[model samples]
Target: MPVDQPHSSAPDILHGWGARQRGGRIRVKGGGQVSQIYAIRQAIAKGIVAFYQKYVDEQSKNEIKDILLTYDRTLLVADPRRCEPKKFGGPGARARFQKSYR
Candidate 1:
């Protein structure tokens, strides 16, 4: 979708020259802007792969997957890291209350 579209929350990766010419709408939830963008990108990449597999030849499907991986590997793979939960002794994860003796 176009970046100016009201529901287009993700970045304008769809407008890139290598992107699929077909048009479709996507909605992503449960994350910050960066997260949402990544989710949308992965979704788009998967969708393109599926489309190629269904209508195009196997060689083209592999080509699309390779292009996406070359452009950004994360577009096809999710990051495994997550936020460490805050501990009881500290205000945040990996942080501890200061101890001062005078």
Candidate 2:
């Protein structure tokens, strides 16, 4: 996948920690730079764990998980924050309709 240079570091981290041995394509849906990067990293991390599960022993799998967590807690954890819904009387999430009096 072609990611922006600023957001390219996360994947490099995974590659540095032995993930380069495994290769596969990833397709990510909608999101901005940071979100897309997070999704890609999470997918890569999960892929690594799955690969280990299939080929390596349990101890090594746990070690990989620990290493990922230590490097970035969010690598395996999904972010919980979402965009707030727009209010009924507002044009945006938090903005209220403008007051006008003649």
lDDT of 2 by residue, 50-72 (tens): 88889878887798888888978
> For every model shown, what is its TM-score relative to the native structure?
0.60, 0.67
Model 2 RMSD vs true structure: 3.8
lDDT of candidate 1 at residue 101, scale 0 to 100? 100
Tell me how candidate 1 scores on lDDT.
0.71
lDDT of each: 0.71, 0.78
Clashing pairs in 1: none
Off by over 4 Å in 2: 1-20, 89-102
Over 40-81, each residue of candidate 1 has an lDDT whose tens digit, in order, gives 767877887787789888987797778777867877787899
- Alpha carbon deviation, residue 85, candidate 2 (Å): 1.8
| Index of the highest-TM-score prediction | 2
Root mean square deviation (Cα) for candidate 1? 5.1
